[model samples]
Target: EFRDMKTEEPEVAPSPEKDKFEIIGKSTSRIDGEKIVTGRAPYTHDIKLRGMLYGKILRSPHACAEVISMDISQVQSLPGVKAAIQLKKGRVTYAGEQVAAVAAVDEKTAEQALKLIKVEYKSLPFAVTEEKAMEEGAPQVRKRPNVQKFNEYTRGNIDKGFKEADFVLENTYKTAVEIHHPAETHGSVAKWEGERLTVWDSTQAIFGVRDGLARALKIPASRIKVIKHYMGGGFGSKLGINDYTVAAAMLAKQANKPVKIILSRRENSLCVGNRPSSLQTIKGGVKKDGTLTALYLKNYTSGGIGRGDYCSEPVVDLYKCPNVQVEEHSVFTNTGASRPTRAPGHVQGTFALEGFLEELANKINLDPLELRKKNYSTKNQGDKETPYSSKGLNKCYQLGAEKIGWKRRNKRPGEGNGKVRRGLGVASQIWWGVGRAGTQADVKLHPDGSVEAICGTQDIGCGTRTYMATITAETLGLRPKDVTVKIGNTEYPWCGGSGGSTTTPSVAPAIRDAALKAADYLKKMAAENLEVKADDIIIGNRKFSN
Candidate 1:
């Protein structure tokens, strides 16, 4: 029998100074702290079941090649090799594209089987660099030239704005591609019980995997249930279902036994998503007094065999520039598709726009901080029509400057004589502070007066579980220890998968509001039992009293 968490008394002191006596903002230790520290967290690969097959994939070796022929006969004929598949006649568009896969009784056998499967390739001319592809005579990565999408945006008359400007500055900035190496490599353990499919995947969205499995296998959604109790990390790479997830499910169905497919570190790096490299140019005109007159930005980037766009997101809205023109272009390369990284496009934009602003400020003989302050807009300049929920950029700038002693910064570069250079650079930023849609939270107050907060969201080192506990405890007038947080289950209510730094602001309020509603119901019930109005009673000393 399971013990109810509510009945157990917490081993801590109780306080009742505030109207709502509970812990919210106080930095309570994470409930999963001990488990994580002790290496007791049950990750996806830790799962073990009866008679599970190991899966290994065969990959292409050429950057751009056509698979002319594949010989998997030796691999299939090998002992303990349960299944093997190859897509040879079809083009292997990328290096390390999964050509085939094998399931064997053991990892060693599965790996050996992969090597036995040989493939032939017809090499094709490849273009990796964006600049080379855009040249007059470069091999076409796709049917079109090295232009994925060339989009232009304008707010006002650019010629008029440039005419009004006393000065203009333009420069190009480049950023390199970054890989998403989640602590846990991408993998999935699929168990098929007759027609029913169950997948234990290392992923951010369980339902997304389920949907993919359902569609790929031509099975109903009800037949599939994907569970991801805990993930090492995804960084947006695991936001949707991946090819490996589908492969594992298919292998399990074919083998008539559970199959676990976990890629090696090398495989993860090759197949998993990565942030596309970017090259951006910003041209801004500014007045002598440090006011931005006009800004024009052009970005060139590659999504690597997929579509990508840079909306000039940071430049088009960051400052109070009236005349703005933004253009973006994304080209395809013979690499993996670009996945959304943290603050996608914004980080690149910040580096370019901020760096340019610093240069422009130097030209105008104005402090960078003061220049940004002069261009600060209480409203978002991107949409121009839509206002923000709240903007603390100006306040953050002032408070940060004062705390960091902005006045001490040397106005002239190369003035510092010390071995170590002391420099202060300030950049202004704003995030669209809204969470994803279709979120549901359930807060329950047991008869023994403990709280349980349930939601279908994962805590990827972001203190989401603890935040939910705080919200629940705050509403019920209870301490952190009195609340049990439950999450990362498809069985629970729906919630947007965590991304875009929207989890905290978006879901925290929903959890708090749900907890409050539950608490109000409980309060009314308790007051009726005590023969007093709900307003007459006060929450104190972890109990309802007069």
Candidate 2:
């Protein structure tokens, strides 16, 4: 069953019935553009403290192994070794699993100290592919014996729908493992002050990091504050504090000094998260007229020894059909854990679904665009069953087709070729993030007339700072330059992390409301000065007079 997580509804402000907008919807320069260009922005790695020491981890060499013994005696006597820890108990699950760590005055010393440590392991049989892991007697990756579990989803009568179909198509598709190699490798600088822990982390979700650190350290959430004003990237990898962050905290506590740890590029490759590879089997039927009859799909995916579902989502209702069946399953393998990428499962699903549908269209002698338009659902068939708040999908498809002259596309592949083959493909997709719950914004107008808008969300190169300033300036009858937007701090009010495609629909209205409220306050002040009703005085370009 499709379910949407609860999200906040943006408050709509009453129109002031005025126009001549100065900023809203117009392109504007980013507030942090100068800092970015000049390399003046302070990222987490830029933090340096007086007693800070660098940290490095010694990782396992084998893909799958049992840690039999760990010796850190040589590492302890290294030139600048301050602290070291051996893997206390658990089995080494994957290559690069930290067997030990060392803190030193410098990275060179840290590197030397790490090499001094010794670890002996008992290697275990392993399977890298999802299919291999599923074999009857294949080496078990997870403690669970089997590699697959069924998560069947159904709607309507599939057997009858298949019976009515004139043609049926079945195919399997595969995607490769993808990494979220954000430019900024995962790093954390932890400094303890009595009971409080301050962390400078490179992460997408600072608030989530704070909570994760607090929980991992057995400290109250209030005692942990994570600061990450400028992050290189996440795609989705940096959503929360990883074990490395926690390890930095633990090492700092043991060393009794500030500790900084950044995963080396090699370690980052194995430890950082990625989009898991998936195998999907699609069985679909269509009529001679290009109408869909039944759609059945099954998905199996591996997240590198980690467990999570990676299904062909939105499959339950991507297109309209009388009968549909979907089963999503996940299994563990000796690979990196999966994390959300740009569109997560939807991008992969669309690639397979759209590609298959194009083939189906060819077999049925129908235009691909026309074929998709025929199956558009009036309501969200995949989930809440709610009518769309608004749908421009048909218009989008039509406009795109017209602009691209899709009618001229080679109907058959290999029809036009010399050295380069020319084949045109069309794909349709939908993302359903209206917004998330609990976002607050505060707008204030300075005595000198400049306005400030504050929300706890990062820009992440999405132009959030510019858009917010524009929204505020437009509402207050001012220019974008007259407004300021502050963000990327947990100290500010709660706002969703800037990951999903919901930022505009989520934050824009709040900015407008805040600007309107600030204007109302100014109007009240102006009414007293102009000897007229508050509503009679209109706010305009740096002036509050009626």
Clash list (residue pairs), candidate 2:
304-335, 305-333
**Tens digit per residue, CA lDDT, model 1, 1-546:** 111122342221233356544566466888778887898987888878799999888887876888878888898789998878763466665676788888899999999998998888889887666776667777777767667556777888777888889899989999888788988988889999989998888887777777788888899988887777677888988888887778777788788888899988988877778787788888889888988888988888877766554637788888888899988888777777788887787878888899999999888888898899888776677537567677888889889989999899889655778788878878866556576665777787676766788886777677888888876777667776678888777776667667778777766766766766665566687799999998676664577876
lDDT: worst 10-residue window of model 2: 1-10
Worst 10 residues of 1 by lDDT: 1-10
Q: Rate the local accuracy (lDDT) of all candidates.
A: 0.78, 0.77
Q: What TM-score against the true fold does each predicted structure earn?
A: 0.91, 0.92
Top lDDT prediction, candidate number: 1
